[model samples]
Target: MLTRPISEGNLLTEHNVHQNYRPDVDGLRAIAILGVLGYHAFPGEVPGGFLGVDVFFVISGYLISTIIFRSLEQKKFSFAEFYAHRIRRIFPALILVLIVSLLIARNVMLPNEFAVFGRHAAAGAGFVENFVLWRESSYFDVATTLKPLMHLWSLAIEEQFYLVFPIISWLAWRTRLKWPLLVAAIGLISFLVYVFSSPISAFFSPLSRAWELMLGAACACLAPKILAPKSAGRSFYGSSFSILGLFLIGLSFFGSLTTSLFARPVLINVMATLGTALLILSGPAASLNRLLLSTRPFVFVGLISYPLYLWHWPIFSFWTIIEGKSIDLTSRVLAVSLSLALAWLTFQFVEYPIRTNKRAKFRLATGLAGFMALAVALGLTAGHWGRHYDANIQKIIDAWDFAGYPEPPGAFHDPKYNFVSWRANTENEILLIGDSHAEQYINAIVASLNSSADRPSPQLMFYSVMSRFGIPQDLLNKIANDQAITRVVVSYFWSIKYGSPKIDYEIRCCGTGLFQTVGTKGGSSPSENEMRSLDAELEQLLTALRRDGREVDVILDNPFGSDLAPRSLVRRNILSGIQINAGVALSRAEAIERTEPYRSRVREIATRVGARVIDPMDSLCNDTGCPAITSDGFPVLKDYDHLSLSTLIHHVGYLNFLR
Candidate 1:
């Protein structure tokens, strides 16, 4: 993620309020942008570079607050003029990026991918991209690298803050409120939310991010009182503070490599924010500020930093999408180089003229607004139109739809637990328990039973659990109270629960035109404590189920990897159109190797609890390999791991135990 700093030279020019430009601040911007660029282009080398966004937030807060405070004191602030300036400064580069992204996406993306991109573009235009991305960070969401506009989330947060903060400042100044005290109170509440909220919310929520900006605001409000009438020894103290600030920032950038983002976000954010504030407090004459920050190269990068941030991620993302996998170092370097060239061109031709043209400011603002509205319209239209595969290609695309499950006629929601259930004519019942891995088999069980006229169908009750915990009390009570329930089926995506390293497999097609698997390892494994907790929870669940005198059957997790994903089998080229590679498969030996730890752990527990162990690999794999597509050309997996509706209905008979 990256954020654009406020334009220091133009902040006060609207109101004829003079503030000296700090070249060191521009130097600081150079550091922040470079950090973000390093993280996106070479994550392994610069793991903590994402903290750059925090640095930008502080810079934005200090610069924008300074302008507002100074104009208020002079009684020259106007809401209309302030927003017009914002439009001029921020809109040109943003509008250019949005239009260009939409154009590129229309040609390169599949129908579903295009639809998703359209919605994201609309969110970006509306300044709600962060909320859209937050909601999409779920089990079934597309991979992050596939999205070109994902970097807009930080821009959305900054714009959202600007929308409300200026009004609050105006009201506080008008009423003669203690601005510093008010800022501190609001900032403290936001910081608490950042510290206590869920990981996803803490990362994307505006409330959780506001405190970083407030640190800069506090500096602006108190700088006059603290820095005025400097003593003879002030220069020495300034140099020391500046040096310490740089050290803290450098430490956070490198220290984050070993730390999980969710494990200690408070420490990382605080170091970056406080470090930025201290550097500003140290004044321009500080030794480091004069020698390092005021250098020409640093200031030049700082000047074009906004456009550069907007350009880099999309270039890298598109490259990944086109190549159908993680790119090589040469590709990354070329992308960065291309982004720099585009950013410099955009600043020279598009941004500079629009921002500096004082006489046409009103017209330029109005035109930019109109163009933004048009971008939103185009995005909405794209989403509404959905996928547009050719008739033959569409049949292949339709086979991957995960929602093709046939709903049973008697299906209804359980009033007590709010889960889906269906009653059969007979008194026999089968209770399905666990996470989504269990739910995926519901339709398959129904289909299997319906086709088998000789057997009696049982009532299906699914209990979906989000985490790896033992069956809850409410679920246990239902089993105890219902005598008709004779069978219990348990399943889960156990490799994920038992902390297996995620490996993404890509089916690539190039000049060779031969489909081959390329695997890339990602995500961290769970700690020893987490693994122990999961083991204990699993044992408790099985023991309780067996104690009820029911036939307990534990179905092992299915063989899955990115190679099995439907998207991996399909590729789009501008000249050739859709290319389907249905021969993609994973070797049975490798599948077993990947899932052996989970299978061994589950088997040991089930054996002790007297539960029957069922393995899906018995049907999904053969002596050679497990194919992503069936013999008839239907996709087996909807995503990286989840079984498709078509797969459950026709490919495997593992769930026949339910009958």
Candidate 2:
């Protein structure tokens, strides 16, 4: 689709001769880059600077649309040629950035985290980073912050949009239909979907993002009509609109992400998008465009913007991983400097050589394919290794069976401790059910059960099945014997901490808990169905046990204090010279008071179910105030609420209440 350079004699009008490059376009690039940089560096600096991506999106749409429209109008529409231009323009620098960053991170990141990087790298090469990111959002894990290629989700959205836009453009040409209307409708519908599903689909999910790209496409189709020159006076309006566009963008950057009431409140994106379009159309005519973007340095940066975007994130992420630090102003500056250096090198050495040379296509294709295959293989290997490690750890947790204990470790070393297995004989056995807190104490209970102290633990077979929020009775029946098992222990942690209204609001607003209870009044209450289901499950278990003349013990929840002491004590002991006593520290009456509410809830549930309630709060507290130091000088609790293994082994002597 390449057009021969227009000779002076071939021009239809003198206006073509006077046409010149626009400097303001470069200034626009500077605006977009600065906004994006500020947003990433200090998020509060420009709340909506994230929209800078929308600015770039519009520019790409306008430029590419112009090129495609011009080529088609000139009777030059070759798919192979179109794709070649795209490959040369995008891949060379992207591949270089990925390779360099992967090498750097491979050496520094933990194996599990490094494996995730490799997988994302593969997804990026396939131009589906958006899909990968969409899947990751559900977990909302800490692992996400470490990914540098996370930003590539936007690139994926743009590429996918372009892939389909041209075919529609070509169809419009062949049929001579109202292509703009059809295209605009597509953009509108995509935007509606985006508005409906945002924050959920924020950084990923192309369906929600197609509108941004299409906004540019629509601008392109309408360009010939809107961009026609008028008079010198008209340039004033054009320049004013251009400046106005920048002002709107600046305003968005300063606005809050939460200000909009309507879904997605995409008005912000729309405004910035419209502004970018105006900026583009204003070029070739508006004096502001010519004066702002035509500078040598600005043009240079714009030329390498693709690579700059690709390199910045990974370098920043790897730096954070290496230093075990957060992203601060200093880190932002370093990241930007490193990104610029890498982008310049990539553009000059890799992109230029590959794009300008025709024969280099073969070499480029081979290298790309080989690199892709290698990355896939390595990623698969790493993933398999991680899965295997998880399996082995899970087995240990299951073997430990921590569900029966009053409190379980917040972080378990073994995954096996998670499961409940049947005794040698599955028939006529006890089954345990509840959420993680119930599961957490399984090991100690199992240990106590196996001890010669409690009726040979009844040769009891236990099933550790439980739900996080509530359990369904159907699953309970599936695991139960026809006749009641010897005894069943039902357990869960009952704490206001779990249902605190203020913590919920903070979590919804700031994406994290605020460390205080949201008093009981403000939050939504649990549904009747959830409560009924829990009640039904308990009643069924009790009925079945009674019919078989079996005893049932519903373990009362252990207390959960601030969950701060253990973490605090460990940090102090490891980092400082303070010889802290953990036991007395953990056993303080005040420390025990924090868990009293959970114990009360357990007692309430026990009364409702006519089951025995086991309260361990007194074991952890005395008549006196809670002591920060345990009598043994071991931190009283392993974590803020749960006793450590050593603490548990010591406390086992006091647990004769079970006997």
Candidate 3:
């Protein structure tokens, strides 16, 4: 599951002293790999199938610990030999995948995307992929399917564990410490960290994830004592335990569990880990183990599971990148089929020869190491010089880097309240408050002020936080007491703030970034309660500002869709080698239908509170559709929704209200 094959002598062996292969364990590997494939390809049907990774952790931990414990007992454990074997097993398929991915990325990806991919590739080769992904694990980060090397995080964690756990095993054996006790102690500490840490940390941190692997290691330590020629009732107990384990694993895979690991309950992972341990403990003679797992088909899949895991995600991801959206069901199935074929070929031709060639083991290890180093260098070079091979594509990608508008020279930073203010020599100031949507208007506001030098500009104070639902009491008091602040503007991604879909809260620095956990496509209609809450909040805030005779304006959210993204405008068919220029537009009718509920509610609240309403749709949309790219070839929206920097400079007249 970590993309390392379980070779016959080391992992598949079950006896304490002998090297007898266990085909049932290979069958278990087959299950884990298939679940992962299902989760990646058809997530809706197998919502919890991602839990297969946790199962893999247990399998890897158990097998690796078995090898270490057996080797230590035999007094033949050499770290050099152990690491060399690991290199031989891990590098063959991984090297091929990384090189192929880089080549494909160079030809197809945009400059910024290629830069990101290059960084991921370097991290993958250096075994630091987990750390890189952990840093970038944010709600605002790009979608998972768009990241080709995202799956490498698990492999990196496994490698890190292999590096540390062996030394711990040796130290414990050297000091005469009980292996089970040591594993339990370390696993307990890791479980505590996993439970208490931030979601992103819990998901990606090797420290937090160690307990799952240790669970497998614990099984290895205890199995011999627990199963040493036990009574006749042992068979009955094994069958029951194995059935229970299968049930738990099945529930995890098919149940209506949340797909977002960050938001999913910890019980899901616990169930999967416990289930995997149960199945492994059930042994080869158990009814399900012998009848189901040891079958020829399952064993074959398990044999190639390492390569299958390595090959599947990139194939799916590259298809998504080329299509500029989620691939169709047919495409996903085809991708899986292709991944299976490639995985088999890689296993037979690449992995088997390198792993089994006894005479050339040293040469193969050294050569693999050198190739890995080369991969690191090429990845770094690609990141540094993100020059696309195609000139026309490179020119189109150059337009993606839209620079931000600079803050005014006389801006004041309020550390206590965490807001920025642009002070002008004027009698009154305009306060802009909300989330990032409010922040996006700063560029247009500055441009408007600069264009109107004939008149005095109002002092500008911007509070870019989630103030739409609940304004900070301190900031509200500041606005109330400060008479110089004569006008207020409110803006937010209204649908996200009041959308009916289940909210998955994510910590975004000082405030939470609200994300709808419905699906990747779109969201459901706003609930009545959400609409009413928004109305009440807006009315309360507007009335408070109006009580002091200050003007208030509510700017509606901009029209947005995946089709309106710049990347979606340019697409490539990798197979056909054809480039297609897809038009970037969202239907005007659809935009209105999406926003009308919140728009009408905000309008009613503002009218009642004596505040004005500003609609961006008037400037952004036409009779036909809302276009993302301007007529002159400039991108209007930076991503999906937010106005681009170019839009701020070129279309400042839309914010005449600010002037």
lDDT: which candidate is best? 1
Error of 3 at 221 (Å): 3.1
Per-candidate TM equals: 0.79, 0.66, 0.84
Question: Per-residue lDDT for 9-105 in model 1, tens only?
Answer: 5543466343577888889888899989988888878777888898999988887788787888788877777777778888899999998988778
Candidate 2 Cα misplacement greater than 4 A, ranges: 1-23, 139-143, 230-234, 257-264, 284-287, 323-325, 358-378, 381-435, 450-659
User: Highest TM-score among the candidates is held by which one?
Assistant: 3
In angstroms, the error of model 3 at 387 is 3.9
Q: Sort by TM-score, best first.
A: 3, 1, 2
User: Which residue window of length 10 is worst by lDDT in model 3?
Assistant: 507-516
Q: What clash count goes with each model?
A: 0, 49, 0
Q: lDDT: which is higher, 2 or 3?
A: 3
- What digit string (tens of lDDT, one per residue) describes model 2 on residues 44-161? 6577777788888877676566556656666766665555556656777776666665666555543455677778887887788888877765322333445778788888887886
